[model samples]
Target: MSLQKALLLCSKDAGRFILGTRPIPRPGAGQVLVKNIAVALNPADFYIQKLAIFVDEYDFPAVAGCDGAGTIADLGEGVRGWRVGDKILYQSHWNPDTAAFQEHTLVDAVRIAKIPPNVTCEQACTLPLALATAAIGMYADYAQPPGSRSGGAALTEPWAEGGRGKYAGQPTLVIGGSSSVGQLAIQLAKLSGFDPIITTASKHNFDYCRAAGATHCIDYHATAYEQLPAAVAAITDKPLGFVYNAIALSKESQDAAWAILAPNGTLAVTAPPLVGKANDVAEDGKRVAWMSASVHVGPHQDMAKRMYGALTGMIERGDIQPNNVELVHGGLAGIPDALSCLEEGKISGVKLVARIADTP
Candidate 1:
């Protein structure tokens, strides 16, 4: 077995991350081995480490990372149309052999997007986890238990036939528009021909949101979460049909989003739906859907593959753009501190990525 460097979480809750070695994994059936060049840090990495949430969910000493961009090193049996040295960006699951914290990992071929010539490895690395979160929330279809919020918004995906520009002239709201997922939501909304795409962000990120196709930008600092509904109301009278709450970390934001949603509209969130029984449909036809955003997950596979299949062309045509990138020094070792930056709310409007080659 060949060895590779990895960042290890020796235990749950309080384990220090150790720079260690693991075997370079081989691709299995329908999988491909990628030699990772860059990996992006996400908020989940912090929560899992600080809260010990999914530690027992996978084998330890855990290797934690979800977003990666790299070149294919090998192909599994039955895999075609891809070969060694193909530039690809992909999302990985919690499986130790496939996690992104190492130089090499196996991924199902369907989960990857070829990196177009215009996109760099760092920018490509930011797309997997965050983009999936937004795309799955807004577009993926799945069944949910009655009154449960474990599914997607079930809207028409822009990648599907007639999905592009399907919502023309309608208004859409993306809370926390400067967030990684929020940025992608704004782009996807634009791709679907949504008009007057409104989003809330710091005044500083107003242009940032606009670059991603947000037509109207609200400063969250000036307008508090409690005031968000009215702020959105002032932007467009066309019934607000879709609201993607990318920063669904609080009850206040969730409630404000619910208030802005049309009776028949869908409120999609990154966290559990907790805005005043908002997940349950009453006399009103309003709905709330929370994204579990893993492309490898059973419910997300159909839509995930559709999006991934179209991703290369989207990038080439300039329909989708990468989030702002902030480079973190020290490669895999730098990820722990980068995760801390995420936990402290220090990073905004940009994805923090570390080049695997920078590990020292």
Candidate 2:
């Protein structure tokens, strides 16, 4: 067996280190061997390292990373829907042998999506994880009609289509419009018919957030939380209906969010909110939905597949543009440096994508 280079984490607190020679994995049943070309880093990568969330200590020398864009080099038995040379992108929570950080990967066929012709490998790498999270969070309760699997694909049933009476034309707020998930959530909210898609971001990102479909951009740092209630009220005193808090939810921010919401409106939070009693409930008995999404979660397979299809369709049609990405140049060596920058929160408004290979 040929050896491949991979970034490995030997322990929960391990800093990324390179393994010069690890056996390249063969594609298992329902899997495809991909030559990875690009990998995108997310906060969870460092958080998992810092917090040591994985259960198996014996599973040391773990490969880290969740999102990548690559090409199918070979397919395993029983795998369909993909062929060698097909360019694709995927996000998975499985172990490092199948992880995105390796030069080669064995990915489950179900988790992969063909990269549209218009998207670059770097651009495609950024979408899977963030889009998957957004789609799942926004459409958790949605289900497609029976007999809808056509062309070996699953159909999507957006929450709006289900006639969820609470969200229609509701004043929805995206707490952090500039974050990758926040950017996608803003667009999804607009697509789902949320009126006055409100968001809170720094003034620097105001224009970009608006371009992505935010109807109102409140400067969260510069402006007081009290101002949000009045601004939301000015638009329509109907109460803020769905607030997607994509930022670090503090008690203050959560309380402010709850204050502006109408009775029974829903609040969806993405980040770990500041644990406080006030952050637990909306003022009007609205539902506070905390989104705990990770690519590793098994139950999201169907949702992930459906979302990749729809998001790919949207990208192909030019409906949603890729996030502003800064492609890192150091290849495998760049992983540690890029990760350090990410941990410091120095990277803002642009995602850092590392090229793992020269080709798709």
Candidate 3:
């Protein structure tokens, strides 16, 4: 076995990330080993450090990263439809060997998507975590069994038969439109033919949100979140059947978005609900869906496989565009500082990507 450089969490306490070496993990059945070219950072990376939310099961020195793009280096038994050199992108699991912060990582082949010819490693790296968050929140049918809806709004997916433009003439709102997940949410809403796709963002990011398919970009700084309902009403009298709270952690934003939801509508939040009972009914019949953005587990696995199958074509045809990327220097070594920028709210509307293969 060959050793490869990785950014290890060092301890169960999650004190700090350190440069270290671990043997390159071999792909198991139905898996692939990827030599990661680029890795993207998310706010989860920061929370995992400060709160150790996802590292609990691991022993000390866990690797933690969620998004990666690279070329396949090896394929395990029964891995079909993918060659060793195919350029692809994937979301990582919780295990250190499977995480994305390492030079090489293992991924279930079914969850990996081939990169389109026009996309770069950095841009592809931004799609996995954010896109999964938005997709599962909007399309996954979590409500099939009574009271069993866990992750999504229970809407039909755009890639499914007759799912495209399924919601034509409907109106929807996306809180925090400039966010990576918010941008994808806006584009997906457009594909669903939602009319008057409204979103909230900083003034500087109004155009950025609009380019991602938002029909109206409300400046949250100028118009307070408390006033979102009135503003949304001014755009369209249609009741908002769907609300994607990309900034669900903010109680104000969550409440504002929830306040605008129509009867029988759904609000998909990245964080656990801060206002209403998640998956429970209110007097008005609005339901909240809390999203867990893992493409590797449970219903998400099948949803991811179907979504990944369609994503390549979507990118090739420009139906979906990758997020704007800002490369962070120093490879894996730069992630901690970049994560700091995320924690301090210094970065916006663009993903922070690192060329992990450039680690020195």
Candidate 4:
């Protein structure tokens, strides 16, 4: 086994991170070994560090990271449609060998997507987790039992038969439109034929949001959450049945979104359901779908496979775009500071990324 540099959370009891070494893992069947070039930070990385939420299931010195973009160093037995040296972006799992903080990681080939010529490794790194969060929240099938739903609007996916332009003239809302996931939601909503795609963001990010396909960008700082319903009403008379709240950590945003949703509508949230009960239905027939964005996980797997299959062409054709990148210096060493920035709410629309191979 070969050693690789990794960032380790030494123990569940510790609140700090340290650099360490781990064995470079070989890809299993249907998997690929990627030499990570860029890895993006997310809020979940901060929470996992502070709380040790998933540590109990792991061995000591757990590795934590979820978004990575790199070049294929080797392919597993029986893998197809990819070759060594191909640039790819993928979502990481909970285990150490598959995590993104390491210099090299193994990913299921089916869950990874090729990076188009237009996108850089830093830009592609920002897409996997955020895009998965948005796509799974908006398109996955609705479970038979509402409580068992895998957290999507169950909308017709634009990649499926007759899915493109399926919701023509429909209106949709995306709270926090300038955020990574929110930006993807706006674009995906546009592909589904939604019109009047309204979103909320800081005034400075209005142009950024519009560029991602949002028809209107509401200045969240200027308009209070309680005033959102009337503000949306002023835009269009269409029934508001769909909402993707990318910044659902804010109770006020969640409440505002729920208030604006029409009867029997779905509100997909990135955070756990804070505005409503996960297993319970609301009185007005509105339902909250809590997003669990992992391509390698349960119910979401099939949908993600289809999405990944189409991702290359989507980028090649300009249907999908990567988020702006703010590169962190010092490679893996700079990750802690980036995670802190995320924790302190300092990072806004742009994603923070690090080049793992540049680790010192």
Candidate 5:
């Protein structure tokens, strides 16, 4: 008759979102129970609710949020190398018991990193999904057919042996450099020693992107997407060998990125391919890989393990840094309004974070 209770945000009915109580879930084998301290917002959290994206039935009572940082409440059977009360950061899915919009959730041990001593929970929460998107886009093995638009760029992961500075002197660009995923890509590119890293962002975020290691920042607002090639040309006479299109939210952005990609280079995007059809790259070796960004799924799982295993070291050593955080008030109750800002594109250069305990 004993059960621990947790609070969660979900669609109580059609178009009705509310916070309600559910039994605190127990971790299964290879899973850990996490008491979420902070949860970071993502664009998908808004689109899934407002547009019914990524869900077929428009199901009610489904939770949102894909990233979080928290403490391990308990460990499940056969789980090793982790103990209760260990602070960790991990990604989550949309399921009610696993999502980050709740006070507690279940996490796979293989897909988590211990929160580094130097980072806060809010900072740690901003990383999981964004880091995964960038890392999987760059380092995970590519699709079998090559340029199939379903895998990563297949570059060597920075965590692998001799991976450090492997791309020394290579030039790269990251579109939407101020975006969460873009910032992580810039940082990772720095770790691999990409010289003269170029990126696109508004002028205000130029320094933000630069802090992440971008040597050049093009103001897309002023330059326009069509002129990216010229803008990039002005920054570096070097060939654009690799482009990370972190802002593939629209075809214009994708097209702009596509225009600048060099032959034999790879274009890695956060969403599905638009200008990157397999046939589109058949004649030339210009490649496109749309990332899945899920550490729990097929093809990405092995790399996820390796990446997560090294994540703590990467953070402690300053090889990877968290994104900027903008706290939204009212915690769970406040997410709807906070999401409105994200949906309206009002939020920029910072990740929106909510403290779960602040829920009333």
Candidate 6:
């Protein structure tokens, strides 16, 4: 086996990633070997480094990256879906050997999505994590339901029964509209016919969020949380259809969300709510449903693939546009700077993607 340089987090201490060489892995059965081209930085990357969420304390020298895009260089046995030269993107919350920070990676065939020729690797990398979370939050199952819309147009028999169709057009609210996941949620909600999709962001991001399909964009920083109910009701008139909180939830935000939700309406929160508790259904008579959007969880994998396929189709057809990506100047050497900027919240409203293959 050949060797490749990768970013490794040898310990849980802050600012601890180190570049070290490791044996380049070959694809196993039902896997594909990829030459990683681009990697996107997410907030979870820093959190994982700080908190060591998935790795054991003894599992030092862990690799850490959740999303990436690349081209297949080799295929393993039983991998019938992909070819040696197909461009693909993947999101995984697994061991570092398969993580996206390295020059080469071996990924499960099922977890990969074919990148359309029209889409750039940088663009594809931006969507996997955000889109998967948005799709899972918007639709109950992996399948897009029949009579669903893709680009403001409707689909015929797009899904089976007991799938995503149940949640269509529910006046959903995507809190934090400027965030990557929030932007994707707005697009997904629109695609699912969720009318009057309301979002809260800074005033400057209102136009961008609207372009992403948010019908109403409120500046949460300026507006009081108590006033959200009236603002949401003015447009929706119906109880809040569905709430997808992209930021960490606070008691004030949760209470505001619950107050506006219609009877039996559901709220799907992505990050930990400020209530400092695990995800749970609130018995506030609003039918609140809290779902953690972590990709490591088992239930997310199958739905992620289906959502990827759908988003790829949409991207190919030019329905959903890619988010603004700030390409970090340095290649692999820039990882530390990028991670630091992300930790300090300096890179907002844009994704920080780096070219990993160009590095020595």
lDDT of model 5 at residue 36? 89
Candidate with better TM-score, 3 vs 4? 3
Instruction: List clashing residue pairs in candidate 1.
Output: none
User: How would you encode candidate 1's per-residue C-alpha lDDT over 1-360 as one tens digit per residue?
Assistant: 789999988888678788899999888999999999999888888776776665568888888888999999999999989989999999988788888889998999987999999999999999888889998888865344444456767789998899999999999999989999999999999999999999999988999999999999998888998888788778888888889999998989888988888987888989877864435564688878787778887667877888899999998898989989999989998988888888899987899999999999
lDDT tens digits, residue span 63-95, model 6: 777788889999989989678888998885547
Considering only N, C-alpha and C atoms within 3 Å, which residue pairs clash in candidate 3?
A: 142-149
User: What local lDDT score does residue 278 receive in model 1, on the 0 to 100 scale?
Assistant: 39
lDDT of 4 by residue, 1-360 (tens): 789899988878646878889899888999999999999998878878988875558886888889999999999999999999999999998688888988999999998999998888999989999989999888876542345745687899999999998988989999999998998999899999999999999999999999999999899888999999999999999998998899898888889999899999999998888777653567888888876787787778889899999998998898989888998888998899889888898988899999886689
Overlapping backbone residue pairs in candidate 2 total: 0
Models ranked on lDDT:
3, 4, 1, 5, 6, 2
Please report, in order, the local distance difference test score of every candidate based on alpha carbons. Answer: 0.87, 0.70, 0.90, 0.88, 0.84, 0.71
> Would you estimate the TM-scores of all the predictions?
0.97, 0.86, 0.97, 0.96, 0.94, 0.87
- Model 3, which residues run further than 4 Å from truth? 143-149
lDDT at 314 for candidate 3? Answer: 92
Question: Which is better, 1 or 6, measured by TM-score?
Answer: 1
lDDT tens digits, residue span 123-145, model 5: 99999999999998888766733
In candidate 4, the residue pairs with backbone N, CA or C atoms under 3 Å apart (3 or more residues apart, or in different chains) clash, namely none
**Candidate 2 structure quality by residue, lDDT tens digits, 236-261:** 76666557777744777777776775
Candidate 6: C-alpha RMSD to true structure equals 5.3
Candidate 3: count of backbone clashes, pairs at least 3 residues apart or interchain: 1
Better of 1 and 3 by lDDT: 3
The model with the greatest TM-score is: 3
Could you tell me the lDDT of residue 210 within candidate 3? Answer: 89
Error at 284, model 2, angstroms: 4.4
Clashing pairs in 6: 146-158, 249-274
